[model samples]
Structure formats: structure tokens, C-alpha cells
Target: MTNTDPDIRRKAEEIIFGMWDTLTEDERKEISEHLTIEEFQKNEYIYKELEIPKCIKWLISGKVKICKSGVTGRDQILRTIVPSEIFSFRAYFANDDYLTSALSFGHSVVASVPMTIIDKLLHTNIQVCRKLIKQLAIELGKADSRTVSLTQKHIRGRLAESLITLKNSYGLEEDGYTLSIYLSREELANMSNMTTSNAIRTLSSFATDKIIAIDGRKIKLINEEELKRISENG
Candidate 1:
């Protein structure tokens, strides 16, 4: 949290204003003046589970995975966040520590806004408080849906849904099929709530059926309609 690059600052402001439009000129200026920009390398830990929240982070670019570790040290991915998304807000609002660990999937730039400033704004600004509540509600709904998808879906359906979710969250490349972000097979399994071997075999089956094409870590959707059908059926 030491950089002051103008481009990063501009993107941070854009994300804040886009999400919460009620900030006054003074409030905006105050935020801009106090914000700190930090760069994290791929696979870097942004925060660990049970750590106290120091700042609210807005991901300006790259991807981050929120995960929790089991007793055996296995990781379960809770959510993947992309640019313009805010993290650690829930912990700050609850006056508690982070429940999950956040890690950078790739080299990422994050804007760190002090919790003190956020708390002050929430106290004085009703609009900001309302926006935060709405955001939290939406996140909760998504979590519920994700839990159902992972627990109830079959192997094929679970993998397909995971791919669809990734595409929707990170978008597709210029080809309109390949995912913008590349994840390893193990990571995909973690996201899908399945074993890595099951994920790999299912992916192979999908490839054989021409539903998807895999090039190392990159997956290209070849039959999105069929994929969606399997997801919906299961």
C-alpha cells in the first residue's frame, strides 16, 4: 500500500463511483487522498483466515480467490473476484476478522482504503450504508446459490456450472470462447467442490463430446448450449 500511480487512482475512483454514486465531491477527494495502492504477485496471500481486517480492498485488475482450508490442509474456494469488485468489507462491517483467506491468482493491483475512513463515511452517509447493505445481500444470495450448485449437481453438472460461473465472472477472450483467466485443474476442482481426478476425467469426457476444448489450462467452449443443458438438468 505505497504506490500512487495516477492510472490506478483513476480506476479506483471509477469503481467506487460506479458502485456507489452518492459520494459527494469532498468525500471523493478524501478517499482519493487517503487511498493506498498495493501490487501483489501471482499466488501471493492478500490476507489469511482469522486475520484482523486492516483495510477494505478494491481489486483494480487481475483475479483473487477467497478460500478456506480444511483440517487436512485441503483448500475450498469460496468465491473468485474480478476487477472492480470489493473484498474484506464484510469483516470490517462486522468488526471481526476475515473468515477466509484471499490470494491473488495472477499479478494484481489492489486499492486499499482504510477501515477508519470507511466507518466514518458509513456513519455520516446514509447512501453509502444503503449501498453496502445491498451489496452484502447480493453476495449472500450468490453464496447460497453456489452452495446448492456444488452440493447437488452431479460430476458433469458441477464442472459445467463451474466453467460457466468462471466465464461469467471473468468474461471471455476476443475469440468469444476461451476464458480470460487460466486456472489449473486442481484449482478448478477446488472451485467445483470435486476431487482433482474427477475434474480432470470429466473435462476429458467433455472434450471427447466436443462440448469443450482444452489447451493446457485454457478451456474453450465449443458447445455452450449443451453445457448449459447439462448444468440445468443436474
Candidate 2:
């Protein structure tokens, strides 16, 4: 939904207070001055590859996908951003243009804090810098794990891992079964490092085996243990 500037700033304040407890009042106030909220439509580009990284982006609501295009013109999804998650600042730290692109996986609300302000804070607030370092490390570890899985796992295993990843990110709907996020097979294939045809066939196979129940784009995880075993074995 839409809200007034004051409302948005209040939300921004709440988010900062919860996440950045180490920041002093003065620092928080200054950072708030540079904060801006943006609304994005599904599939809208948040940042394109090679663009100068100017700000740190936080997803306040909905989902986002970080992706890079390959030599064959296929896009590979690198990561998914959930609510309250911070992303897109690593490129700024590396002092380079964005290496990948970010787009809205669905309609989303995002908050941006300019890197200039962040740099000033980083110089003054040791705690903030440490927090950022830890965050980067966690992301690096996940990336490493994903690399191994995609390179080593068979198509079924990769798709299983992708489903588990989605479940972890969004959880289940009120029915306590269906995946909360709805994605097309092409998007699922991109995230799982497979072709659309493979994704479709594997999904059908999973359904036939009673491992999952599919309702168009909605996939309900019916047998998570079997899925995990497949992922582990592959």
C-alpha cells in the first residue's frame, strides 16, 4: 500500500531501530535524512548490471531476485531477497559498478540509503562496519554452497533445493502447505540452474510420485523429507 512521507519515515525508523541498535541518535537522525522509499512493480529493474552502485537497498516488503545474464543470454538467479533483508551494497564496498542486476520478484517496497551516508557512518561507527562484515561473510558462504549444489547436483536435486530455499524464504500460506511465493516455471528454472523443460518435467514427476502437489504456479511441499534426501544424495 501507499503511505504519506511521515508514515514512510516512521516505518524506516522502526526498521532501523530494530536492526541497527548500535547507532547513536545523531547517526540515526542523519541517516534518516538520506533515506528514501521506493515502490516497484513486478519484473521492474531495481538496478542494472554495470551501473554505479550508489546506495544500499533494503527490501521492506515483498520479494526481489538478483540475477546475472550468461553468454548464452540466459539469466541465472543468484539470490532471493525477503522482507527486512539488506542487499545491493557489496558492489559499493568493492568500489565497482554492479556486477549483477536486481529486479522485483513481485510488487515490492524498498528503502535506499545513499552510500555516501553509509561511508560516513562506517568510518564513525565500528559496530556498523562489523555488522556489515558479518553480513557479507554469511552471503559469501551461501554463495559458495549454492555454487557447489548447482555444479554438482542433478536437475532434480537442484530443483528440490530451490523449492526448499523458497519455503525457507517465504514459508507456507495459511493452509500450511502451499509455497507462499508463486513463480512461473521459467523463473523456477532460472533459479535452479535448469531449462524450463526440465523444470516442468521434474515438477510433474514430483507430483506423480506424491512428493509435491502442483496447482498451476503454486507448489505444495507434501514430502519434504524425500526431497531433502534427493538433494543430499545428489
Candidate 3:
């Protein structure tokens, strides 16, 4: 199901506006007027590679993954976004089409604020500008860290790290062990930088080791400590 409540929209806008502390009441209202909310189903593309981005999208709820296709049509998951995070800003700043595509991991809601509005706000609000700079720096750091982790870590380490990353990004279900988001094996493989068959094999190994329990798309962490140890040691 999709979210269409006016109250939710207002709350999402308010959260964004709060980040731009330098904006006046009129300015906030002006920016909010240009914002639009969109919903995407599981595996739906928010934007595709080479598409010219005209808006900055803020994930309001659910999860999305940004990915790029390799030379052989294999996907490499670059990053995952959770609620209240802004994306598609790189395209706006670069004045180019998107380098990667964003897809909803599940039913998701996002707010799209026009690039023109963002540009205007940046020019008029020093606090907003500072916040954007800080966010960019943090993103760069994360990219660097992920690059090192993906290359240096072993397959088991990579898989364990991927599981922890997913848990952090989406949280736990009501049972407190099952992952909140369910991804297909291919998606999991892409996220872990492995082939689908390899991912399946590794998952089976993890299950046999009693590190995790899998029931179709549902993954429950049975031994979080051991998982962390493997990820750290490798």
C-alpha cells in the first residue's frame, strides 16, 4: 500500500525544512509548494542510469538501493538509503545525468524537491549551504570506507558485513531477529559484491553454521556475535 496522507506529507516537508534552519517562514512555504511526493513498489526504479535528474529526492519511508550495471550487465550495489536521507543531489550538482539507478527495495515513499528550489535555497540560506557541505563530506567518507571494505574483505567477511549493513539500514522486524527488509538472492549478491550462486552458497553456509536462519526472504540473525566476529576478523 502507498502513503497518501496530507499529514505525512506535511511532516516530511517539515523535517526537510527543519534542516534548512536559515530559511524564513515564507521561504519554507515557497519551497514546500514545489515539493511532490511519490510512491514506488518493490523493485520499482526511482530513476535510471543516464536519466537527467531534475529533483533531489528524500526518502521518507522504506528502503532504496543505488546501483550501476557493469560491462556484463551485472549490477553492483553502490549504496542503500533509509528514511530522511537525501539522494540524487549529485546529478543536480554535476549538471549531468544520473550515473546510477535507484530502486525501491520495498514499498517506499519519497519527496522530490525541484533542483531550482534547492539552488535558490542554497543561495539564500547559509545554514542550508553548510549542512549540504557537511553531508557531502560524510558521503565521501562512507564511499571511501565502502570501497576499502569491499576490496579487502574476504567473501565471508563481505557477506557478514552486508548482513550487518542491511540490519542497520532497515532495522529488525517485530520479532527482533528477522530483518525488516526482504531482498531476493540476486539483490543480496549485488549488495555483497558476489554472484547469485555464491551468495546462495554462502547463505547456506551461514545457516549451517547457525549464524543465521533463512526462511525464503526472511533472514533471522541467530548469532549476532559470531557474525560480527567473522566480519571483523576477515
Candidate 4:
């Protein structure tokens, strides 16, 4: 993580303290002293399972996926981290090493906040502690929902839901039809909790039925209502 753009750091700083107007000048200075910015290349492994969690990461740009590997070497993508979201720090709070891995979806920027700073703030700064608790609860809720959706849904339903999730996360491209994120079929399958072959075949079926249009790694939703129905019925 070596991109040295000064403006990026400023943006990251703004994001961290943007909502904390109640912070005193001294507290803000302490925060500035602890925050560090890092960059990641496409497909870079940001953190791996069993690594000791040293800091919290706030994604400032691009995307990241938190996933775990199965005994058979298959990967299951648990969640995708969007800009302004935090990842890989719950283990730190829980006094355990990371249980999953984080990989860059592409070139990305992350602001590293040390555990010491978070601990200090949690004990001394009531506002920051409450904010952290609220944010973690929200993430836990989303994770539980996704767990149910991925496990109970059929392959087609899961795939449709994944497409819908991506749409909501990144929005549409300028074409107003294509998804903003372009992922390989294998990656899509992992995220959808299906085999790569099944994902490819289901996507082809969707294309045939006019549910979606596929162009290389890009996907365009042609019949979003029908896809939504499938997702709901699942």
C-alpha cells in the first residue's frame, strides 16, 4: 500500500471525523496522530485467516471482499465491503485472530486505525464508542440476513439476489443497464455460493430467458422485476 497521494489522506481524514463534530480539538489531534492510509492493488490479499488483527480498516475507495475458504479449497465470499465501511476488526474486539480473509476487488484505499486508538476512544470517548457499537450491530444484522439468503435460496435465486445486491451496492454504469462492478464468473460463483459451472450455466439461462444480458464479465439486468420475483420466491 504505497500510493502517496496527499489528497487521498485528506479525504480519508475527512471521512473518519466527518460525523464527530463533538470531538474536542485535542481528541481530533490524537486521532490524526493514529490514523494511517494504505493502498492495495487489484486482487491483493489485504488480510488472511488466522492473522492477528492489529487495526481496523475503513475502505475509502474501490471495493473489497471478506471471504473464507472451505476444506475443498473452494472460497465462499461472505460480504463485499463498500467505500466508507469498516472490515476485519471484530476479531480484534473479540480478542481473536481474523477468521476470514479480505481481498481487494481492485485498486483500493483503506485508512488504518490502530486498535489502541479504538480502545482508548471506546473507554474515554463516549460518542465514538456508541458509534462503533451501532455500526457493528448493523453489520451483524446484515451478515445474519445474508447467511440465511445464501444458504436457503436455490442457485438461481441466490444468483439473482447477488446481482441485486451488487446493483444496490455499486449502482448501474452510465449505460443505465450494466452493473458497475465487473467480476469473473468464478468470483461471481463464490459470492453467490454456487459452483462456477452452475453460475455460468445459470447466467446463460437467464440470458436466454431475457432476464439478463451478459457481455464478458459485465452483466445487464433486462428484467429486474422477474429477477426480483425469483429472489423473493426463493
| lDDT tens digits, residue span 101-178, model 4 | 999999899888788877877787888778888888998999999989998999999999999989998889998899
Cα lDDT tens digits for candidate 1, 1-234: 456789888888899878878989888888888888888888899999999998988999989999999676889998999899988889877888898999999989888888999888998789989988988999999999988998898999999998998999999999999999999999999988889999999999999999999999999999999999999987
Clashes in model 1: which pairs? none
Question: Per-residue CA lDDT of candidate 3, range 1-234, in tens?
Answer: 345689878878877877666789988888778878888988899999999889888998889999999898998998999999988888778788899999998888998888888898888888888888898889899999888878999989988999999988888999999998888999889988888999999999999999999999999999999999988876
- Model 3 CA lDDT for position 234: 69
Q: Residue 169 of candidate 4: its Cα lDDT?
A: 88
Ranking by TM-score: 2, 4, 1, 3
Q: Which regions of candidate 2 are displaced past 4 Å? A: 1-5
- Tens digits of per-residue lDDT, candidate 2, 73-183, equal 999998899988889999999989999999998888888889999999999999999989999999999999999999999999999999999999989999888999999
Native-vs-model 2 lDDT? 0.91
Clashes of 4: 0
- How far does residue 180 in candidate 2 sit from its true spot (Å)? 0.4
Q: List the residue pairs that clash in candidate 2.
A: none
Worst 10 residues of 1 by lDDT: 1-10
lDDT of each: 0.90, 0.91, 0.89, 0.88
Instruction: Give the clashing residue pairs of candidate 3, or none.
Output: none
